[model samples]
Target: MNQNAEYSAVNDAVRGQFLRRTWAMITPYWRSEEKGRAWLLLAALIGLSLFSVAISVWINHWYKDFYNALEKKDTAAFWQLIGYFGAIAAVAILGAVYRLYLTQMLTIRWRAWLTEKHFARWLADKNYYQLEQGGYTDNPDQRISEDLNNFTSNTLGLGLGLLRNIVSLVSFSIILWGVSGSIEVFGFTIPGYMFWCALVYAGIGSWITHLIGRRLIGLSNQQQRFEADLRFSMVRVRENAESIALYNGVPNENQRLSARFGKVWRNFWDIMKVSKRLTFFTAGYEQIAIIFPFIVAAPRYFAGKIELGELMQINSAFGNVQGNFSWFISAYADLASWRATSDRLLSFHQAMSENEQRAPAIDVRPEGERLVVNDLGMDLADGRHLLTDADMTVEPGQRVMLSGRSGSGKSTLLRAMGHLWPAGHGSIRLPAARYLFLPQKPYLPIGTLKAALSYPQADSVYPPERYAQVLETCRLPHLVGRLDEANHWQRMLSPGEQQRLAFARALLFAPQWLYMDEATSAMDEEDEATLYQALIDELPGLSIVSVGHRSSLKRFHGRHVRIEGGRLQEQLVS
Candidate 1:
């Protein structure tokens, strides 16, 4: 697509469909098991807001008597009115405090649920890795942490604020209408005098505010993206601080970060310019609004048709009506931010769903108590075939070794078996899906050493003794004692040691089938042979399919499979 066409596509998506789609992302948590808590928080916050509105109305009534007493120069009456005002103020203050507390509580609950849901979907089907592989989801870290937090927080707060404002309008409109009695505007007496004035004033102001602030939505959206990009750059720098320092990359890092932050600077400048213009108009509108009611009621007061008290009461009522109607003005920035957050969350949700629909290469099914690959093929993401015309099988206790030249789809085959290779074509018939794939560089998840070894499984499933035995047998005796130590195990441990831990893990689980991709290559031949022997001795029924390029590995497997020139080399072990 052309640049103009792409811009048009994005513009249309933001305006037309994305917002409606955002609501779908919001419903699951509210309708799920957590619905009771969600509704409870919502009701409590809403009640507080409504109670605040009622307090405002009561104070409006108090305004009339207070001003009447003042106009009469009655000291005692004035003091009595002040006491009444103080009492009403206390309730309003309490209402405001509880309102804030409840809103924050609601925000965290909603954000927690949303964050977890996204985390699961993103990590569940290996969506995080696949999303990156396909270039499907953008800035997943941002989406999960910052964007999810912003989405739930702003959506709940802004949505509730909107609801409260609507209710306030309904409640205050009546009061305003009653205050402004019908009077002759142009030789005809109009019904509900205060209602007509309030309506006209609010309508004109709201239209002008919308017109002035319409550019804010796009600005806000751009600002958020720019900010996220800048923040991501900073986080990258932090993560790679050691490498950058070793290479003396301060100047380069500074330049790169400056470029990223420059986007933030430029976009913020645009927002600032627009904000300056908006502030002038909104501020002027507010200043004039304070006196507008009194101006409309002034003529009646001078005609001796209404007292000073009535004028003051009318002023307060009109202010309430105007306040309720001007919610858009009060929340314009938040609305803009919410729109941007909604756009991000909506895109994330859609990307996850689209990924679920995407076709993957590996087809998993059970076949007669043996792991089998029938016409199995592996391809790169771009449809370039990697492994072609491959076939293999392993029954229980049948240990097999896979050998292939580099770039011969060795790891790709293993990935396919694990159902992580979604880009390739062909079906893999497995004994069961519970099989584990131990990569040459095993993943040490962020937690205890025990948790790292028992990755993709709960630590509670294995006993301490089991964890201890595997660590010792795999030549990871150093880690055996530190099973409870928690850290980023991959970065913390040496490659050889990590590989050792991987084999140690294989010892703990009685996996029906195991796919080891160069899993023992990092270790010495003796250690490798010992670990393989330990597996055979400990779990004789364990079926193993391993990929490695070592002569020593031949003795460990009863069968050998090799791949060359994108096809499996059919040479069996004796």
Candidate 2:
């Protein structure tokens, strides 16, 4: 990967479109139902932060009195100062503890709100399905699970830290000016010369820190993506463990996994290299800053222009001013990380917004008594036509079976009818009735059998007896007793058993219009025949549109249609 080019692209995006999208993502939460609580928490944190800075200012003055008492060897004055210091310390500690507690409370609340909102959009209007089919985005799972978390915590941390430093900078600059007095340099008398010295020192450090650490923004972004990809590859292996084992594909899987990790390792090495250079500069800069104040103030001290007390105060005040001014230098790494996280979240937000706004090629409406396809056309992502100007309609209570050559459009037609495919221009009007589609491989969510059986619906929607009856009718008597038992049903059951569970689901759901896309392919002819007969006897008025290759399916359907040469041709079903 060309890191420079990628860095440029991400940098350009962050500069141009980052803030608008970021604001859009952030503002909704504050304006949401939790606005009252959010603003209250924010106010408390800000107040506590300012309080902590005030305590620092108080401690700076104490340094003057405490040092003078020591210089005079006044035992009573020194003891009195020590007692005062204890009181100030107690107040400072109390403020610091509450500040941390409140910050955590607000971060979690904000994260939860943003996560729920993103989840809704991801699943809304079938956006998840559309995004997967179009391949318009990658690993939305990670974006939601990881990126939002990083964005929330970093944004709060950086924002509050900056605010605290700004206040500190203003507060300490005044103190440094008054105590350092005046200095004559090259026959020119300079006022607040020490403040100027501290400013220039921090200014140079901040500039150098940015120059060395800017690449980390892009590197961090790439690192996150590479890590997610590696994790996803391993997850795929686990999901398909049986298939991989049957083929003895361990070597190939291992090679693929290793290649993904190679990208992560190389990119992280680049991160370490840049970080090493940055660390060298920052560490040296901080060490020099510690003694730089004393070096600048020493001449006046030796000249008897100021007492030991004022000189010590000058050191304490100068440290605060310089540290506050160098906030950017100290936080450069965190700033880079925050910006990278912001860019990722911004891109994800934009992709979802675009999907929501774009006009789909195939317009599907739900406003009819029968399923209607009018001039329905479908195409591959490459623009190769799958089905062209095909018109078909199924009346209420009709059982129709559609068949075609593999890859000819059998499945695409079903997807278009279901409003999932958008690569082709057409219109499909679905009946205003409950409908369900069973794909070749049924999805059994990892949960209780009753929950999986009642998927897309709560388990409470059906009684216990109804679930048991449906399971028995679908020839899954074994599972009938295990409805309350939870397991990963997809991995635990055989393919044939999973299909049977899908039928049990359909029987439980009882949709008026049913569509099956090779849903029975995993079952034997006898089992498939038994299930079809059960459906016919159980739901006499249920309409089914099935796409399959088995001849046994023909006996259940009163009408047969075949797609040939990108068109639907009617067939006589004996």
lDDT of 1 by residue, 110-226 (tens): 888887777888888788877777665457788789888888888878888788878878877887777777789679988778767777777888888888887887788777777
Q: Each candidate's root-mean-square deviation in Å?
A: 3.2, 1.8
Task: Supply candidate 1's per-residue lDDT for 77.
Answer: 93
For candidate 2, the per-residue lDDT at 341 reads 81
Clashing residue pairs in candidate 2 are none
Indicate the worst ten consecutive residues by lDDT in candidate 2: 1-10
Clashes of each: 1, 0
Best by TM-score: 2
| Runs with alpha carbons beyond 4 Å of true place in candidate 2 | 1-13
Query: Candidate 1: lDDT of 438?
Result: 84
**How do the residues 1-574 of candidate 2 rate in per-residue lDDT, one tens digit apiece?**
1334534555676686677768777788889999999999999999998998899999999999999999999999999999999999999999999999999999999999999999999999889987776666667899899999998998889999999999998999999999988888899999999999999999999999989998998899889889998999999999999999999999999999999999999999999999999999999999999899899999999999998988989999999999999999999999888887887777676667778998988889998799889998898978899999999999999999999999999998998887788788878999999989999999999999999999989999998999999988988998877989999999999999999999989998889999999999999999899898888888879999999999988999999999999999999878
